[model samples]
Target: MKPSSFLSLARFGLKTILFRKTDPILGTIIVTDRCNLKCRHCSVNNITSVLYPYAQIRDEMHKLYDMGVRILFFCGGETFLWRDGDRNLRDLVTEAKDMGFLIVNVVTNGTFPIDLPEADLILLSLDGARERHDLVRGPTFDVIMENVQNATADNICFYMAINRLNKDAVREVCILARETKNVRAVSFNFHTPYPDTRELALSKEEKKACCAVIADMMKEGAPVFNLKSAFPYLIENSFPTPCRQCVVMENGRLSVCGRCIDVPGLCAECGYFFVAEYTLLFRGKPKVVFEMLRTYLKYV
Candidate 1:
C-alpha cells in the first residue's frame, strides 16, 4: 500500500469512528454472476448467468467512487470469465485503479489463468487440502495451485470459507499460504448458512474451535490475514450487523454489507470476518482499530 493511500484510508477511519458515520469506505462491484464452478456451499452463482457489460460496470464504478468507496472489489460468477467485446477482467481492474480507487481487488476461484498484476490483491479461493477442497468445490484444487505457481505477480491471497467438510484443514491452508510461491496470505470466513446450505453451518462450539486453531497458527508465524482481536466477537456472533462502512453494488442495484443482505434473519448470524472487523472498528473498538492497522499493513 502506498503511503498516500494509507493516509487517506486512515483519515476515513478516524472520521468514521469519531462521528459514527454510515458512509461506506469499501465497495464491491459484482461484475457478473455467471460462474463456472458450482461449489456445494454457494447459492449466489449462475442464477441468471449474465455477464454485465463494460459501460454499465464503468458507470457503477463512477457511482461507487462518487459515493466515497476507496477500497473496491470486482467480484463475480467468475471474474476471469468476464469479457465485453475484446476487454477482459484486467481492463476492469486497471480502469478502477485509474478511476482513483486506492485499493482494487479481484476475487476468483483460480480456475483460469491469472494475469491481473495491477490488482492490489487477487483473492483466490483455496478452501482446503486437495481432498477436502475437491469435495467442496469439485476437482480443481491442483489446477488452482498450478495457476498460483505460474501467476504473473505475487499478489495472490488464498481465501477459504470453512465449513463442516473443511474445518479440520485450517492448518493445512495456513501452511500452504506461508510456503506458496505467489500467495501473500490467507483470509477466512465461516460458512454463513444460507437457506440451502444450512447443514454446513458450524455450531458455536465449532466456530470457537476454528478460531482457536487460527490463533495458534498466527502465533506459529503463519501468514493469516485476519485480526485476532475480532475472534471473540466472531465466535459469538456478537458484532454489529450490516457493516455501514461496506456496501455492494450488483448490476444496477446497491446492497449494504453484502449481496445476501436481503435474506431475512441473515444479519444476526453473519460469518464474514470483514463485516465484524469493520463494524467494530467503526464503532470505536480500540483493539479492532489497532489490530486492523497492523494486519492490513503486514499483508494487504
Candidate 2:
C-alpha cells in the first residue's frame, strides 16, 4: 500500500473510532454469480449466473465510493469469468483506482489466469493441499497452482475457508503461502455454514484447534494476513456481528457487513475472522487495534 493511501485510511480509522461512526470504509461488489466449478461448501454460486453489465457495475462502484468506501473488493462466483464485451476484471481494478478507491482487491477461486497487477491483493481461494482441496473444490488444484505460479504480480493472498474436510490442511496452505513466489500471505476464515452446508461447520473445539495452528504458524514467521489478537472472539463468536465499517453491494442492492447478513440466525455462528477483527477494532479493543496495525502493515 502507498504511504498516502495508508495515511488516508489511518485518518478514516481514527475518525471512526473517536466518533463511533457507523459509516462503511470497505465495500464489496459482486461482479457475477457465474462460476465454472461448484464447491461443496458454497451456497451462493450459480443462483443467477448472470454477468452483470459493465455500465451497472460502474454505477455500483460510484455508489460505494460516494458512501465512503475507500477499500473496494470485486468479488465473484468467478471474477475471471466476468467480461462485458471489451471490459474485463483488470479494467475494473484500474478503473476503480482511477475513480480514487485507495485500495482495490479482487476475490477469485484461482481457476483462471491472474494478470491483474493493478489490484492491491487478489484473494485467491486455495482451501487446502491437493487431495483435500480437490475434494472440496473439485480437481482443479493443479490448474490453480499453475495460475498462481505464473501470475503477473506478487499480490496474491491465499484465502482458505477452514471446514471439517480441509481443517487439517491449514498448515500445508500456510507453508505454501510462505514459500510461493507470487503469493504474499495467507488469510483465513472458518467456514460460515449456510443452511445447506450446516454439516461442514466446526465445533468450538475444532475452531480452537485451528486457531492454535494458525497462531503457531505466525510465531514461526509465516506471513499471515489475519490478526491473532482476534482469534478468541472469532472462536467464541463473541465479537459484534454485522461490522459497521464494512458493507457489500451485489447487483446494485446494498447490505451491511456481508451478503450473509440476510441469512437469519447465521450471525451468531459467524466465523469470518475479519468481522471479529474489524468490529473489535472500531469498538476500541486495544489489543485488536494494535495487532491489526502490526499485521496489516506487515502483510497487506
Candidate 3:
C-alpha cells in the first residue's frame, strides 16, 4: 500500500474510533447476482440473474464516494460473468480507482482467468483442498488453482469460507497460500447460515477447533491472513453486529453492512471475521487495532 493510502485509512480508523461514528468507510457494490457455478452453501447466487448496466454501476460508485467511502469492493454472484456490452469487471475496477477510491478490490470465485492487474486485491474463493472443496463448490478447484498459477498479477488472496464440509482443509489452504506462486495469504470466514444454507453452519465446538488449527498454522509460519487475536470473537459471535463502518450497495439499494444484515436473524449469527475485527477495533480494542495494523502491513 502507498504511504498516502495507508495514512488515509489510519486517519479514518482514528476518527471513527474517537467520534463513535456510524457512517461507512468501506463500501461493497454487488455488480451482479448472476453466477456460473452454484455452490451448495450459497444463497445469494442467481436469484434473478440480473447484471446492473455500466451507467447504473458508475452512478452507484459515485453515490458511495459521495457518502464518504474510500475503500471499494466489487462483489458478485460471479464478478467475471458480469458484462455490459463489451465492458467487463476490469472496467468497473479501473473506474473505481479513477473515482478516487483508495483501494479497489474484487471478490471472485477464480473460475475465470485472473487478468485484472488493476485491482488492488483479487480475493479468490478457494474453499479447501481439491476433494473437500469440490464437494461444496463442485469440481473446479484444480481449474481455479491453474488460473491462479497463470494469473498476470501477484495480488491474489486465497479466501476460504469454512463450514462443516471443508473445516478440516483450512490447514491445507494455509499451506497452499504459503506455497502458491502469485498468492498473497489465506483469509478465513466461518459459514454464515443464510436460511437455505443453515445445514452447513459449524457447531460452536467445531468453530473453536477450526480457530485453534488456524492459530497453530499461523504460529508455524503459514500465510494465514486472518488476525489470530480475533478468532475467539468469531467463534463465540460475541462482537457487535451490522458494523456501521461498512456498507453494501446492490441493485440500487444501500444497506448497512451487507445483504445479510437484511436477513431476519443473520446478524446475531454473523461469522464474518472482518466484521468482528472492525467492530472490536472501533470499540477501542488495543490488541485488535495493533493486530490489524500488523496484518495490513504484512498482507496489503
For each candidate, the alpha-carbon lDDT, in order, equals 0.94, 0.93, 0.92
TM-score, prediction 1: 0.99
- Backbone clash total, candidate 1: 1
Tens-place lDDT digits, model 2, residues 1-300:
788888998888888899999999999999999999999999999999999999999999999999999999999899999999999999999999999999899999999888999999999999998999999999999999999999999999999999999999989999999999899999999999899999999999999999999999989988999989899888888999889899998988999999999899999999998899899999888898898888778766
Error of 2 at 253 (Å): 0.5
TM-score of each: 0.99, 0.99, 0.99
For candidate 1, the per-residue lDDT at 176 reads 97
- What's the ranking of the predictions by TM-score, best on top? 1, 2, 3
Query: Which pairs clash in the backbone of model 1?
Result: 35-77
Off by over 4 Å in 2: none
Clashing pairs in 3: none
Whichever of 1 and 2 has more lDDT, that candidate is 1
Q: In angstroms, how far off is 124's CA in candidate 1?
A: 0.6
Poorest stretch of ten by lDDT in candidate 2: 291-300
Better of 1 and 3 by lDDT: 1
| For model 1, the run of ten residues with the poorest summed lDDT | 16-25
